[model samples]
Target: MKRKEYAWAYLFISAPIVGFLLFAFIPLSYSVYVSFTEYSGYQAPVFTGTNNYAKLALHDELFWKTLFNTFYSALSIPIGMVVALGIAMSLNQKVRGIRFFRTMFFLPTISSVIALTLLWKWIFNDSYGLLNYLLELIGIQGPAWLSSETWAMPAMIIQGVWAGLGINMVLYLAALQGVPKSFHEAAEIDGASGWQRFVKITIPCISPTTLYILITSTITALQDFPRFQIMTEGGPNYSTTTIVYYLFQNAFRYMSMGYASAMAWALGLLILAITLLNFWLSKRWVHYE
Candidate 1:
């Protein structure tokens, strides 16, 4: 009977285990190997040792530019966090039609990504776009948002912040609701002002949620690619080109698969370091109780 039970357990897990070895582990191993060679997909890989990495480090000015642009665009993470927290607090209030407001705010998150990207592209159009038209009404001319080098990255950041706010707000709302009402009541009894209660009680209570949001937001920012593809195509002097976009260009456009794999490894290390740093720093402020 025990043998039969063990056989059944293995049967249940076998497919997934095999699938992971084939799809995940094998591909990962090959990618690491490929990073050390020079190859187009159709050609035999020629071993190049550390030349790909050396080129990225010493010769790739475009890679450096893309790295800077990616970090620069990550500014949206903080802006989104602040807006989400504020809206979440408002949504937590005992008010009529709050559910309806929440549903409306969350609508964009449920919409198709391609559709949303195209919609935002139109919204940032130079003359006929809604943003520019609104500016005309106010007697201030709006710049060509996605077409201008200076404004393209910021435009992408705005779209990202708007698109992400609803989900983060929902997470914050859940955290807020989980906070003990007794804490607030006690704070009031101690003559704590509203801001004081928020700072000392609510913020401390919801600290774990904040840390979760921050870490996820950073990871998302690091891998962002769709906005560049749909909104800017990393144009306007490649002002909006990010690391992923640069990787894609190297892999497909230049047929530099080895170079792209090296970039992927580098990006993976960067993300791993940042994630570990977040975890280490979180011990200082992420409250559990």
Candidate 2:
């Protein structure tokens, strides 16, 4: 009877498992196979045996540039996560209309990416943008935000941080609420100052949430694509050309499918390496009790 029950339980999940194998696993396997071949999408994939990777390594300057851009975008992860945690903590306090503020903060996460990108594009516009207007009011000259190579990547980073902040804030809010009230009260009775209690108790209790935010935000920053394609198009001397954007251009624009496949594999390996490193380091600081 137990065996039959177990069989039925597995049968219920079989459809999704089969779908994963067919749609995701098989496609990934085929991409890996074709990375060694020389083929555009239209032609037969002839086995070239690592030539694609060799060319990408030896002569592809754009590949390295795109990788560096991705790294720069990822640099904001720590700062953004700290900001999100602060927002979450403030909202978790004893205050009225908490739901209203939470909704306001979270609505941006659901806004259309294209719309938000265009909105920020105008905000960062050199001529009549709000940013320039504010800077002028403060007696400071504003630089071109999206048009100049120096400001284009930073503009994208600002937008990326804004777009992602809400989701991470909500996650931290939930974690903050889950912490025991007894801990905070005990710290107060022990003559701990507000900052000391926060540093010792609040931060340690929230380490798991911090770890979660760090991993996901870093990955999102590294893999951002849409605005890079639509807004900058990797322009202003390739300042905003992220790895994924470059991969899209190679696969679709240049019709270098095999080389694109090689890039895709390399990107997956890099992300996997970073994620594994985060997991390994979590043991040192991420506390659960």
RMSD of each: 0.9, 1.9
lDDT of 1: 0.94
Error of 2 at 163 (Å): 1.1
Which segments of candidate 2 are over 4 A away from where they belong? 1-12
User: lDDT tens string, model 2, 237-256?
Assistant: 88989999999998999898
Q: What TM-score, to 2 decimals, does candidate 2 have?
A: 0.94
User: Each prediction's TM-score against the native?
Assistant: 0.98, 0.94
lDDT (0 to 1) per candidate? 0.94, 0.89
Candidate 1, which segments miss by more than 4 Å at Cα?
none
